[model samples]
Target: MASSPSHLSSGSDLEKREKPLSELTLDKPAESPYLNDALEKRVWRKLDLYVLPVVSVFYLLSFIDRTNVANARVAGMQADLKMTNHDYSVALTVTYVPYIIAELPSNLLLKAVGPNWMLPTMLTLWGIVATLQGVVTSYSGLLACRFFLGLFEGGVFPGLVLYLSFFYPRQRLQWRISAFFSCASLSGAFSGLLAFGIINLDGVGGKRGWAWIFFLEGIFTVLFGVVSFWLLPKSPAHAYFFNENEKNYVIERLKDDGATGKDASVDAFSWREVRKAFMLPQTWILGVVLFCDGTVLYGLAYFAPSIIQGLGFTAARAQLMSVPPFAVAFVTATISAFISDHYHCRGLVLIFSSVMCVIGFGMFLGSQSHSVQYGSLFMSIPGTYIVAPTLSTWLANNAAPHTRRATAIAIGFILTNSGGILATWLLGALSPAPRYTKATIVLLVFSVLMVLFSALNLGYLWDQNKKKRVIREGMDRSKEDPSLGDKSAWFEYNL
Candidate 1:
């Protein structure tokens, strides 16, 4: 391997020429178990089965437990507690404050403790807090529960994104991310149907239907968390079900795609990489794009029941109506993700997704008909759902060195969930009952902003690739430094 010359562009690659290729993307595969194409397929199937499904259920339960509070509101808990729209919005806002504060620290802790410990612990704690929401007697009690739930749940989304990156290369990651993340859409449908049934249990065991919604759903999370503590493999290499050939394939492919540390794991934390992630242009730029998506996402999650019920339906009927849009979104997000992976494009897919948001949210503001506004949700649900996996994968794909990628993911999530804080207010406080024109208008404007920003991101990344191509053509860049990561001439940005 040729050493990086002092004149070979500026920055970290020049700063640490002596750093091992382990910190940079490996150009060649290391020695591995006797492996063939068929064996590789077999290994990936195991990963998809064991890893993907397990994590999906973790997120599904977590999301359901979190959002069922909305269902509870419609089922009569809000009135029972004497809460106003402002009080409900305040409780929801309380959740997101902790959520944003805890994002980076939680990812860093996930790195320190490993997913098996950090994820299951967080899941179990949040589950307990969610269950306790059922028994709260005052508005203050509800606020306290929401705060703890946010603190525990804050890490799950970013943690899952980082955890999956451990096993798959950049190109293949978005689909797997989609596969699990699609569960987020499913959770809404599931919450609706579950609330529909459980709310029927009102007056059973001296508990109202809304109370059962929390108790039953939270208990389910607790049981799942206990099982996950045992079921989840520590990492790809530690997956006991995989044969030696499968393990090596996972390790080698990841390292070839720029895994750090001995044995191609995520590696120990680096302050320099964390700082590098903070300084990247994409970190803040795309973070704003996510802010728009988060507003729509939580708007739907927190207010969908109320929004639907306001459309001249009974509360229980509204719960059932919310199901189909999410069902459609689950399928839409899955298909779009496959297309994203197959085409190796994130920016265009994001633009298309954002445009769907524009059309969907626009209908709410543009039309006076209830059915038309209701119909728009079909498009709106999938639009916002698609953004998270695609945008998060884009950052994860570009940032290199394990710590840098992980931090970039956390930062993106922070900016993403911060929008949820505004969502509680906009979709709840700013937009009142019976006719939420204000919320509809806000969603529409944000959708347009997202479309514009997605285009900007695509243009910027394309120009960056052009510059890197020039550097690659002019130098023996393979020898420069893997530490350059996505910044290196060797890496072609996925546009």
Candidate 2:
């Protein structure tokens, strides 16, 4: 039988290129059976059991802490602190400064510290800061706490994406990312319910309802952080639940999928990798795309409750109303991620979701009826949430070498947070809410641009894939250098 070329090389070092691919084979141990479909399924189930839930918990808290100020607004936070409109917007903007600045550095830190340690540490620090927001007497105090909160929380989402890429193949990554990101939507849903209950604590212990919201949520976050220290595994090699055979199987599966040494932590930071990540046009394309979506996402997350309040519901009723769109979003985003992964078509899925958002925003801009606006929210929320994981995984899957992928993910997230900053100022101050027609129009413009970017991204990936295909078919020997990683001739982009 003609031998299939070996794509499974180990380590991040340049030495992996020393051997020719035609001379290499699937190098499983003699004692181990080749991984069959059933065992692969079992492995995935086990991984999901350990990895997904803990990461989701961490992110859920992150989303809540970052956006809960929105909930607090209706609970009398702005009035109690005597914050002017400008003051509040500045507080929101400051958080993103540290948040964006810390993202890339945090990814590098995660590589050195290991995710199990680094993640819980960030969560704990942010939790303390988030909890302390309850005690703030002035707007400046709120800004300080939020800045620290952003500092701690910045790298987590991107860092987790890099960590997960180590375990799953590119074809399988979107659903996992979506499943993890669904927690953000779930956090949105839960924040509303939690705020509804917490706001009823008005005047208890002489503290306002909004203060209690921060204090309680922070305490829960701290407790969860403590638990994550034990539950979250660093890598396949470090997982306690997996025996030696299972560990080897997990590691081998990734290598077989064209990932080299992804199961190992990228301990040393590389400037070259950083440069490579920046050099890719797709990285900037996706970053700009994320920025556009980020405006919509953060704008909605930080203000959705307020937007609902504008629709004639009481603050409490508005909180309750905010829950459904996010709940629906969680469901739709999970389904979209699953379909994107199953079809290996992240770009198309991203485009579809972007277009949906544009349509929803168009309705929001034109319609006068509250009912139409509310329905438009259902359209907009799911589109915004679904686009996040799909686009993130798309960029991640196309990047090669673990460190380079980490850098790209980090840069992309920085853009995401930058958009969040712009969104805050635009929606909060510039638009003059109670009816943010101007902001809705701005967001609609962003969505229209996102659809164009997504299509362009898809076309670029298709063109690159075709070019690679031509090179691959023309080659007599499949002896490409493995060290080239994603740049290697055999690496195909998922379109």
How high is each candidate's TM-score? 0.92, 0.92
lDDT of each: 0.83, 0.83
The lDDT of model 2 is 0.83
- Misplaced by over 4 Å in model 2 are 1-35, 261-268, 474-478
Q: Write the per-residue lDDT of candidate 1 for residues 1-495, one digit (tens) a residue.
A: 123334323455443333332343434532221223344467778889888998899889878987899999999999999999999999999998898888898887786788888898889899999999999989999999999999999999999999998888777889999988899999999999999999989999999899999999999898888888987887887897886656766776676556443333335677888899999887777888988898889889888888899889999999999999999989998998999999887898998999998999888778889999899898899998998789989888878777888899999989888888889999787888767888888888998888898888888889998897787675864457556666766666777
Estimate candidate 1's alpha-carbon lDDT, on a 0 to 1 scale.
0.83
- For each of the candidates, the C-alpha root-mean-square deviation to the true structure, in angstroms, is 7.4, 5.9
Model 1 misplaced stretches (Cα beyond 4 Å): 1-35, 259-266
Which residue window of length 10 is worst by lDDT in model 2? Answer: 1-10
TM-score of 1: 0.92
Q: Write the per-residue lDDT of candidate 2 for residues 146-222, one digit (tens) a residue.
A: 89999988988998898888777777788999998998999899999999999999999988999999999999998
